[model samples]
Target chain A: MSTTKYFAPSVEYAAKILIYLSRYKSKQSTLTEISKNLDINKSACLRVLKTLEANNFVYYNSETKKYSLGTYISVLGKRVGENLDYLRIINQFLEEVCELTGLTAALVQRVSFDRVMFISQYQTQIQPRLSISVGNRFPLTEVSYGKWILANVSEEERNYHLREGLKKVTSYTRTNLQKYIDELSEIKRSNILVSRQEYTNNVTAISSALYDWKGQILGMIALVGVSSLIDEAEEQRLCTVLKEVTNRCNEHLIQLKIEAYEFPYESKITQ
Target chain B: MSTTKYFAPSVEYAAKILIYLSRYKSKQSTLTEISKNLDINKSACLRVLKTLEANNFVYYNSETKKYSLGTYISVLGKRVGENLDYLRIINQFLEEVCELTGLTAALVQRVSFDRVMFISQYQTQIQPRLSISVGNRFPLTEVSYGKWILANVSEEERNYHLREGLKKVTSYTRTNLQKYIDELSEIKRSNILVSRQEYTNNVTAISSALYDWKGQILGMIALVGVSSLIDEAEEQRLCTVLKEVTNRCNEHLIQLKIEAYEFPYESKITQ
Candidate 1:
């Protein structure tokens, strides 16, 4: 009896092709193009593409003879959200925040220095909700999430990150070595970061850092809306709610045995 | 002149790793496991994972010596939602349907028999709101989307499909040779299919097919909610709304030069 391990090998190849397709989602590619890009043989690429097409992971445009992500790729994303428990944990709180503040609630995690990835959002039930998307990236220094992350960074690490991270994002982006050091100190004192239309005109965001059980800064959850919707009073009210939610989430994390990070600058006066 | 395409290729590889990690998100996998799963060389997989770790697409657990998807992945998904224009188009109408009918509204594209990916959803406000995830799959014959899709097959093709597709899902699944022929005929006559507690007890769904500008069935959009919420009068109202919204969506498709399939079924006089 001869036993062949064919499924694993083919599944592996299929996985690679899927990875490649995800990178070139906006730009369609042909078999030859994929072959050349991945440096794999043409036949192997063709085989992988065929399998993906069958599974609805990739689609071939018969007219152009090019390939793009199939509609099913979005389905894969939906599975990711479900498996990660994001929908269960965050949905209601996000809706409440959006309802109370009339601002979009965005959850962002740091991906790279100038890029933070958006995970989920609850949009305000009004015209011109802050437009953003899942799997999109934003500069860490140009948005509330970026500032919130920076506020949690150590003093020594702040300068290095600012120089390397904020270089490409904004012309008005702060680059002064000493200024960043001082700003981090101030943020540490405040335990909150406010960006007044930093990312876009008339869009303001207030963000606080979220922690895992191990005390690592996991990400930032921000409440963003038009500046007109968030005056000083409204901002303060949002801050209170945001703080409470963060605290509750922290407790949830602890219950799950994830470590929680403490705010560096804790002040009873602000509360 | 030595031009380094280092960043582009690495970025591409890194993106692939991100997508790969997306599949095995909750369970940490070692470098060897990932290489074997992706069918890349062990050394190459390590390099890709390193770059992903550096970019925060993955996090390495030192103690376990395995890697899990970092918080950054969720962040990226959120950003993708914010930036994707097509989602916004569907979301506007999805919200209205949810509000009018007080049921969960879903925009889904068929992935496979095992999966139907959710793009966007307006979940019911009630506790224990139908637990549907963005990316999940169900047997085609047991769900609203499946019935609607099944109704789209041509006469001869429909028979072949039932023989192959219907036998696998459920024992109570409509695999009766004559009954299936008649069911498809009825669906063709009515243009809408209803699954009354077929997938889950006390849950009902009514779905209509959607087409692209090219007249291909893109997928089906279904209104799903508890059976109690969709009484006969409410069901009629919700179906009217679904028809209107689907028509509006079809108009958008036509503007893009897409043609919709004409429904063969006429309104029944009994109702």
Candidate 2:
């Protein structure tokens, strides 16, 4: 077996470059400008820039030595827009959950290792909502959605992520690996994860996985609000609503021909 | 003078890889999969993927060997959402214009060389709204928004984009360079670009430029509807409404401290 693990190192670099570009897409940036701004080595940056230019990610004015994002960046922008339309189908359901629970509702997904991305959110009319951008990422190990995803991940993958030690994002975050793993197993069995300010203080969040037709986790739906508003009773009610709304969303996905899958692998150790 | 352009090569490569990744983001292809799909050498794909990976634009599962988008993909998603918020701010104005003219009202931005991204839209009650995604891009040299953007682009950039001939996307699209440039100049001075079935037969569109506080062309506001409903009188009314709405948006941008600039340079050649 060829033991070379496919490390997509360049993809990571390109993504970093794109994020850097997002901040200044409206303006032109020179090669040295990008290198200095990003702290990337000049020669490597030059090579990447050449590849990007050839591919249409940017256009370089040979005369002025200026570079701007190419038209294709907008193509990706368009895809993002199309993906957002998927959220509209669940908006009403999310709003109802928010109204019924008096909590801020959110949709989130585990986009990568140790990072959970917020997809959409609905705020209660009275309580102030968390300022979470749709595409913003937070530490996966320290969030309710993160735990939910961890609950579903394979043991090998879980160990890989956990080996780094859950970087403490907040004082309330779980620090013990065994405890965190146990909690994930429990949540996996029960299909819900609840935390009292795991990511922030004075906030309670209860989340359930949003599954496709075949039971694969597409994302998580959660209700978060002031800790005072979500006691055990409120948590139960929120869970009930979360389950119902998630099922409704799954049905919508089914209509769209998406299959939901259960966690694909069996847990190695019995809890 | 050091004539060697910096960031040009990297920008080019970035654009190419981004376009490639976009074609597969929805499909969830692996690096090997992308290599095959793009018909590029696997080693090159690996290099590109590594760069994208480091930047959080693409992610791969070492266990499953599956590749998907990373957290940074959401950065563009958030941009579209922010732009949607901008559209929301002007929705009332667009709705009023739609009602006044019995046409479909839209907010568009030049997203690429030949594409206009639709930000938001409202259709008159009687007319079925043209279904366009919030991030959808249309060619800039063909439709009303395209013509408007072409008219507003600096002479140099405009010539650069037009040198290879505008991509003919629709049957009524103009292929002649000089004629189109001439028409664009007329539209630029008049502050309006009108198209009759240029993008789609039976659809007539009239557009005006949206400017920032400093009066720079930010985007275009357009009205589209069936040709029968868009006579000379209707075109005049729609043009007036577009100008007024654009002015309101500009005032809003001014309040937000955005600078508007006109096309950087004027063409030397005259009709």
Candidate 3:
């Protein structure tokens, strides 16, 4: 909450270790393996892990002589996931979108500046539905969801990722940095972004940003399917429905803002 | 993990603040209120909260000048929620229980020394089912889920909470420590626990522990509904289905152990 950043080394290291555990692996790891892989000294790692364990941030198994994150971490994560008013709003709206359009409808959240987390998703009744589990995190710059978020962040932050150079995932990947920036600006201006075979060979995605009552970008709500499902006529329909989803979310969020006094931690997705 | 406990005061205090926030209030609290209420020094509270905020463990709303837990907490909670293999295994098994008995089914985990957490739940197709959400936490000495976990923990740890004296929530609430201890022992020896309106009126719960391959109690799976639904005739059917559910989870956990070699973290629930 401080205007000036206050750094705490032990706290920072503990967080880094948790992020590493969450990102790199889900199973138990030995002190040796964690210390070596994360490059923290064994003794200090022992202290922090001990602290984390005592606080229910990590769990230690004596028989296996290894460590894994504790269940309390999910208690925290549930709080985070619960704070997204859009998730509540998207429930009926996403289902309706899927019902009307016969495609997958999803809500993604920007976890890190350059990574988006799939928080909620629904699949249509069509055969051979595209399925991805909730809580899946991916690089924002590599997928259509990435462009949807990249379009909202500050131009400097977007340029930082641009300067890192977008990798060619498919032949259609945009390699021109300037053109990519231009494309992002246009997406931002238009409030929609489209991708065809940018991450995988056959999948195509169309995404539009979901906004809170104050107009801050929360993330993207999108409808996706195979490339064949996204033909010229379908794209227009998809855009219209996707736009409707966002508008509905915004409306629900405004209602939630009115309902804010009834609870704490409401409408926290303004950013 | 070391056998001897090494106390970290700072870490301990930080956890206490978080717990207080979770238990006492879900809304934003100020430094003065938290400091005076928790009896922590304002300066020290500021430092710890700032550290927590830095790690995305807490969020500060500059507009209202208040603090609530950050979204990252739920991100961690989701990870922990994802780790509960029984939740994954009990999906089909729970539906079977609900289908056979027309009652709600659920899974609960031991979250703290004196508390149990509801991690997964399923509703029956029948109208007016008893509903308790996932992530709901209650005192370990009061609920059927508590007795299931109390039956497993060390005698000393169990006695500490027992000494706290269970409050009378309903007419069936067990307030006598001796009776509570006897109840827990019977449940532990029998490997199951049942509650008839011990916590809430007109509700009944029957629970049995789910163990990993190592025979450690990972959590509990049960069917619960209106007290009338838990009639003796129905109790037998509930036990049969619940046991099947536990067996299915154990089999899945063993399969996971075999698959552990393919990933870095595995068989973590043994802790």
Candidate 4:
């Protein structure tokens, strides 16, 4: 929690290795493959992998002479999932949105200044539904949630994020700086974003920002589906619902305030 | 992973810190508190924490000057949950057990030689259900699953586990090694474990080992409830059902074999 950033190289390598394993979890990798692919020194990566294996962060398959993510990652994940109240609350709200709209609902968390990742998602029991999974990361300048994020940050920060040229993700992607800025201003006013195949083809997304007590954007809740499935009337209804759900979520979070910071790790038995 | 254990101290400290954060997730701990409690050197801990923060493994509260497990932990956790096929299959089977038996059903994973943790659980809607949560660890020599684990291991390995000797949990606890070995033999024949208030008072548990294609005991599936609620007839019925469910699970797992090693990380849409 230091103000000045100081990274431990070994720690960074370990995190990278764990993430690499998670990314290609279906493939168990040898020490040589992992060390080479991640560009870490062979002996150093081996030491970290060995340490991870001992801690159960990565599982070692002795017979195959390879490694995969171990039990501890899931253990830590379950603990975190149970502990975070805001996450739980947002998830409940997202479920409601998913059920009502019969679309895919996802809770995305801003991981860094320019990056956000889907932490949890609820998909409809409908054929040809969106196949987005948790852990998928997107840039702050792309996607509906990204606009909500850009709409809330300070002007300087916003410009810095956009300093990188806009990506034309699809034919429908908005690349004009002025129009994008205007939309962000609109998002700031209405607290909702509506994108018609802006990031991905045939996908329409509506998103609303979740705010802490200080009005800082924590993250965003989004509803995504194929654009063809969402008519003009449907998009309006979706936007309205997202705004209300996010508003209620933000209000509840504000009232919970700092106490919400204390995430209870226990899963209560529901009678 | 190497044959000779060469732990990267910094990596070890990072894992320990993250686990500690998960253990006391409800509390945001200052650097001094974390460093002192985990016995990690202050500067070394700070560097690791900073690195973790950069990777979103730990969240740093600038205002409070404290730390908590960050967004990336949940991201990794979700990916692991999705990627592990055995976990998904077992969870599905546990859900069936909970519904059919109206008891708390849990999928326990062997984390180490002498330790196992509840990776997932399904509880019935009935009142007074067992309140065990995921991430709760138990010694491999305790609980119904522990008994199953003991029964599956080699006699020498089992003896080593019991070397510390069993602490009599209750009057019902079987402290006699002779009787315990006889029961383990019975378990080997039956492939089912029935413990009546042995580990915790007034708790009855039925467990069956899950096996890999190699026929090694991977972990266990356990049904738990209050002793009084499980009448004689109910216990017999429960035992029969658990045996059937676990048998099907084991058969399916054996068929899965090495391909099961590759966990699909995608959340497929259920139509």
Scored by lDDT, the top model is: 4
Candidate 4 versus truth, CA RMSD in Å, comes to 8.2
First chain of candidate 1, TM-score: 0.71
Compose the digit string of candidate 2's lDDT tens values, residues B208-231.
776665555667777887777667
For residues A1-271, write the lDDT of model 1, one tens digit per residue.
Answer: 0022111333334444544555525446778888887777776567667545544456666555776655445544544454444333555666776787777887777654445667678887588788666556666565547665666656544544466554423444455556655666676565566776655667777777677657677676778778877789988888888877766766665565443222222221132
| Full candidate order by DockQ, most accurate first | 4, 3, 2, 1
TM-score of chain A of each: 0.71, 0.71, 0.80, 0.85
Candidate 3 is scored at a TM of 0.80
Predictions ranked by lDDT, top down? 4, 3, 2, 1
List chain B TM-scores, each candidate: 0.71, 0.68, 0.76, 0.85
TM-score of each: 0.60, 0.66, 0.80, 0.82
TM-score attained by model 2: 0.66
Give DockQ: model 3: 0.28
Q: Each prediction's DockQ? A: 0.14, 0.21, 0.28, 0.36
Using DockQ, give the best candidate's number. Answer: 4
Which one wins by lDDT: 2 or 3?
Answer: 3
Q: Model 1, residue A5: displacement in angstroms?
A: 24
Residue-wise lDDT of candidate 3 within B218-244, one digit each (tens)?
677777888875678877777777777
lDDT of 1 at B171: 36
Q: Compose the digit string of candidate 2's lDDT tens values, residues A176-229.
A: 888988898898787777888878788888887766555567678887777776
